[model samples]
Target chain A: QQQVKQSPQSLIVQKGGIPIINCAYENTAFDYFPWYQQFPGKGPALLIAIRPDVSEKKEGRFTISFNKSAKQFSLHIMDSQPGDSATYFCAAKSAGGTSYGKLTFGQGTILTVHP
Target chain B: GAGVSQSPSNKVTEKGKDVELRCDPISGHTALYWYRQSLGQGLEFLIYFQGNSAPDKSGLPSDRFSAERTGGSVSTLTIQRTQQEDSAVYLCASSFRTGGRDEQFFGPGTRLTVL
Candidate 1:
């Protein structure tokens, strides 16, 4: 079973627009959420992350809005640019477990920004 | 400040052949992980190693898949009797520690194609 589910397998947006990708998980034990960005033929890079303790966290143009009760989190890219075009992935990790540090990833979202 | 590095960025082999992929983590990192990313699929966890602890291999798809970390810095994932379904991008990542909050640095994945 997929532990984390993501929606909108592909997204297209004009430059300067905002692109939002959402993810949901059923495991309430997950406390750490992170987003990764990957370019073609490259590995995913850590974009931003958030802890369930806070409702939201923003870094530069990337923002993570997390709802602990709903077991959901979303990534919003403000002033999206053409360079932001890449595959985005949402992942979660349990704080305590034999599987600690093992991240469960969601289906990736391919975001394309048109100039 | 070197990042995680993977070898043989791309590999092509026939079915029933065995293949080995390697990863070199950043200096001094104590945690290493292997993940598989299939086309249009999420990053699937395969194995994890932290310090001298026993590796968590529960995520490995089958006995044909195995990995070893030597000297706590380099890792090699070996696949025996590969099949077409084994075709995917194998990714490696490393972190400073197994802490829930530590960011993972990923290497450019090794794309394996089984024909």
Candidate 2:
């Protein structure tokens, strides 16, 4: 019940194109969802996040769409540039748990934005 | 810089050798997390520390993995009798848990290669 499955292990899109990555989870206790972007030779950085109470949250060109009933979420990139190319990971974490709020990540999707 | 930093950016070790990865979390941050990312795989939560104490270690894959934090500051992850499967990027993150929604800041990561 701790797994977060992500789709499209690899995604390729042209510049200015929108790429959407989807993820699903089995644990219903997860209240917070976050998307992380990792570049070559660097650690993943927080791109954007959303809470289950809301359906969608946007930061700059990144958007997180959450579906509470379906136990799924997605990350959409608006006008994706080549600079946005990287491995994207979707993670979920519950509020209060023995896990100490450790994030459960998906398999990851390698996003390549072509110029 | 004030961001999280890791030492020995790259490491190449022979099989059966033990390796230790270090992490310096953001100053004054109370929470620290360790994650491992294999090639083309998503980040795996290894362990997390709350004020130098790890509450849950279920994420650790085997008995060969161990980690510790001191002074609520620096943390180290040690892999004993490393195998080919132990080769991966070890990333560290720190967060100030406010009991609400918190953001984790990640370090560049230490790449470990077992030959």
Error of 1 at A6 (Å): 0.5
Query: Which candidate ranks first by TM-score, i.e. highest?
Result: 1
Please report how far candidate 2 places residue B41 from its true position, in Å.
0.8
* Tens-digit lDDT string for candidate 1 (A3-109): 89998899999999999999999887888899999999999999999999999999999999999888999999999999999999999998787447899999999
Q: What DockQ does each listed candidate score?
A: 0.91, 0.73
Candidate 1 per-residue lDDT over residues B1-115, each given as its tens digit: 7899999899999999999999999999999999999999989999999999999898999999999999988999999999999999999999999776899999999999999
Q: Pick the candidate with the highest lDDT.
A: 1
Model 1 CAPRI quality: high
Residues B14-69 of candidate 2 have per-residue lDDT tens digits of 99999999999999889888999998788898888877454457789999999888
Please give the clash total of every predicted structure, in order: 0, 0
| Model 2: residues with Cα > 4 Å off, grouped in runs | B52-54
Model-by-model lDDT, in order?
0.94, 0.89
